[model samples]
Target chain A: MPEVLKIKNLHQTFEQGTVNENRVLRGIDLNLEAGDFVTIIGSNGAGKSTLLNSIAGTLPIQEGQIILKGTDITKLPVTKRAKNISRVFQDPKMGTAVRLTVEENLALAMKRGQHRRFRPGVKSQDRKFFKKQLAQLNLNLENRLETEIGLLSGGQRQAITLLMATLQRPDLILLDEHTAALDPQTSITVMQLTEKLISEQHLTAFMVTHNMEDAIRYGNRLIMLHQGRVEIDLAGEDKQNLTVPKLMELFQKHVGSGLEDDTILLA
Target chain B: MAIGVYLTFRILDLADMTAEGSFPLGGAVATMCIIKGINPILATIAAFIGGLIAGLVTGILNTKLRIPSLLAGIITMTGLYSITSRVMQNAANVSLLGKKTVFTIAQNWGLSRNNAVIAMGLIIALLVIMLLVVFFKTEIGLAMRATGDNPQMSAANGIKTQGMKILGYMISNGCIALSGGLLAQNNGFADLNSGVGTLVIGLASIIIAEVLIRNLSIGGRLLTLVVGAIIYRLILALVFQMNVEPSDAKLASALVLVVCLTLPNFHLPRNLKGGKQNARSTKD
Candidate 1:
């Protein structure tokens, strides 16, 4: 039960002191232990994305702390935190370089967190390794090593991106609605690939989703956020038999009021 | 110099206007160094360093100071005018009529003046191309390329995108300045006014190369830059022989670029790969 990630009293405010002053995260805390796959769902503007951004270091933490594997990373920039934290963004285009070849992108991932050097970018040996990894995707991308990633379909790009995130076995992986941009069938494909990869590596992961079924169907735990705070947390046996209606019941029982956003329930 | 333009304009996806300033800066530094009795080889190296500094300044402005890339380049180009003048001893022109240069030194080795210029030019160009080919194949170089294509992905993957950009600017401007230094010697003098219209010529050369070839390997693409420059020069020579106004040379270059850039949109047979049709100017 050793903590892999810990957030304490995290607070985020946008446009402080301006007329449009707003608070996205208000004194929130979270803890994740080894191999804990947590799927988070919340209403629109309930700080789901803001929380993920804060953890990923894209948005600066205004207060409190984020510690990963015993180091205080609250002040580390995105690039610096990237050694341990890998991310698959909502936009598939954001996950990979467009003009780089498939093997070149994979080579970049192979050297993640390592110092860049003057050595050849894609060594012959590495190409074979990349091909082997690509073959596992079952997407026939292994034969297209020299093809530019931009030429690939969005699903293929996302698959490659997911592979890249796990290439070096990151301490944690963050999925910020990574499959939200894909078509329904492609999203299912990517989601399955995600589950397989995370389970295979026993990876500790944090995911944000807007769909309640997705929030319940995937991951080892589920969290519901309301008003920048964790309203309900479920895990193990409590989460195993959960359905959309049961989850809704849990939300109402916990919050003492109906959920603010029915669009999430309908989704 | 066109390769330098390619690095920023094509590879980095930033139209860096600093090439105009750095080119003449290289000329000014090298000319002054040669006049001070420095070896021609050392003078050219000094020019390269000068360009690197100018590129570094622009990179800092764009990355650290958060200036737009285009604006940062223009700022550097405008500011370098006074610096170039100062380097030329407060004069707008510095003559190297009787001074030593790489070309003159090559002539001292029992070659004719034209032969010396040709040999020296080929050697320097080959050396630059080889170095760039090797560097771009390296891990650091690949990362730099990725930084240009997608900064967000680069940062997510643990790359310091800003550092890569600064490095690209240095290399691009370094080549440009080195070319400036050599051109000053070849043209027999360095003039502060030489920077004007330099970017347009470089862009024209690059566009010509694109029109001539499609989907080549990185090394092959770099080689075509040399061929493209030669062809562009030949075209200019033909234009001059046609008795058109020599002062309108810039106009011709602009027209050639415009045609090549838009020709793809006209659905020409240039797409040898049978792949997706790509408009030349819209790669960005």
Candidate 2:
């Protein structure tokens, strides 16, 4: 399988040459194959979000080369790169415009990265397509096309946001702890839906999570970051039988230090 | 004109002071064009283009130079004051005394001058409202709406938010200038002080209509804005007829705006109405 994403010599340092300089991602390198669903686990400040932001073009690349498929996108602005890259933010409210109706939000998502013309928003023909897409979520959002996204619950918003991110089948989808704001029950439901959607579309995805069980349970591959570097990258059979305790033992064995409970509590 | 204010203030979420300068700028430009023997319709369009240029400068200052939006508008508004005078050959006012304005042309068709002005204003306002209604429903229009509603989300979804904001200001001030052009022709004079309370008038119209029509389609809201402006002008006329001082008109307009703005935040007595939670529980 062709490499869908390549991160070469990635280095993100905050407030460089200042007294408060913090080295976030220190010369990190990564490669993702097509249809890879990789779940990443890390401590609070382990540079997970920073890494995602760099790839998503939300942050300027201080020193790195981010090659997506065959094109170098390290210098692309967030809006320009959004054609091939879609993202679900940690905040449910960050995913969709609150004042817009459900169908309008979907319509905006439909033209992601495409040249937007002066055509009517949410056309009659597109409405039927949107309804069909909403129905697949089984959230009964098809009936609420005209409802403002703000009036929906957090779980509903996240589900709709997930749908928006995948509406056009982006080359890569980044979920930045997308369900972290929801209750445990809703989180599980959203996660299940996410798994269903990713598999259904054969999408390449990078999911950052604080939950160890989720890190192990969903994706085919798993990665654990410690101090701005990948400490463990497990896949296939090695990941299938993994448990939280076994993962911690492996972390301790590799990093030559006792795993801190504070980091695990974040899980 | 209030619809233009609504686009900037409500839709784009920018409190642009450029309207004050651009309003008079429109009249000044139109007066200049009339002096050059240009057609009135073409002169009005010239004024609109002038306003669009003024808005473009303000947008660049805010977006490219990183100035605060309010300050950017203020700077542009202040600069346009001198520019408007320059456009009128260094005079504080310009007279279009015997020129053929849209109203004058209409009056030649066997209608009273007063009726002609009213008819022209209504027709022009309705045309603008119809165009805006259609424009706001377009794909690019949805992107602009999203930019105002949540700029971060807009950028995330590949919408050029800063560009959208600039376009919003351009359209906004263009409408204000067009209104100024009409006012100049209607009154047969474009005075520097003609735009003194124009922003207040626009706000008054928008707030009054929003209060009256709480939930409406985008098209309906645009229509209500025009109706609200007409009603507001009639009220001002009535106040003048009651022998009130003309100098107090500005104060009266300001007070009307204040009351309308604060009305929505008024809380009813707890027992006066069935609360939402209580009603839901009762239904259950």
Docking class of 1: medium
- In model 2, the clashing pairs are none
Candidate fnat values, all: 0.84, 0.76
lDDT tens digits by residue: candidate 2, A57-91: 99999997999999999999999999999999888
Compute DockQ for each candidate against the true complex: 0.60, 0.49
- CA error at residue A131 for candidate 2, angstroms: 1.2
lDDT of 1 at A8: 96
Candidate 1 versus the native: TM-score?
0.93
The CA lDDT at B75 in model 2 is 96
Cα deviation of B69, candidate 2, in Å: 0.9
Docking class of 2: acceptable
Q: Could you tell me the lDDT of residue A244 within candidate 1?
A: 89
Error of 2 at A186 (Å): 2.3
Give model 1's DockQ, 2 decimals: 0.60
Please provide, for model 2 over B1-284, each residue's C-alpha lDDT reduced to its tens digit, 9 standing for 90 to 100: 78778888877877888889999999998888988999998999999899899889888998889999999989999999998988888888888988888788789888898899888888889888888888888999999988887787788899998898998999999999999988898888888877788888998898778666655667888899998898888777776788878789888778777876676557433322322322232122
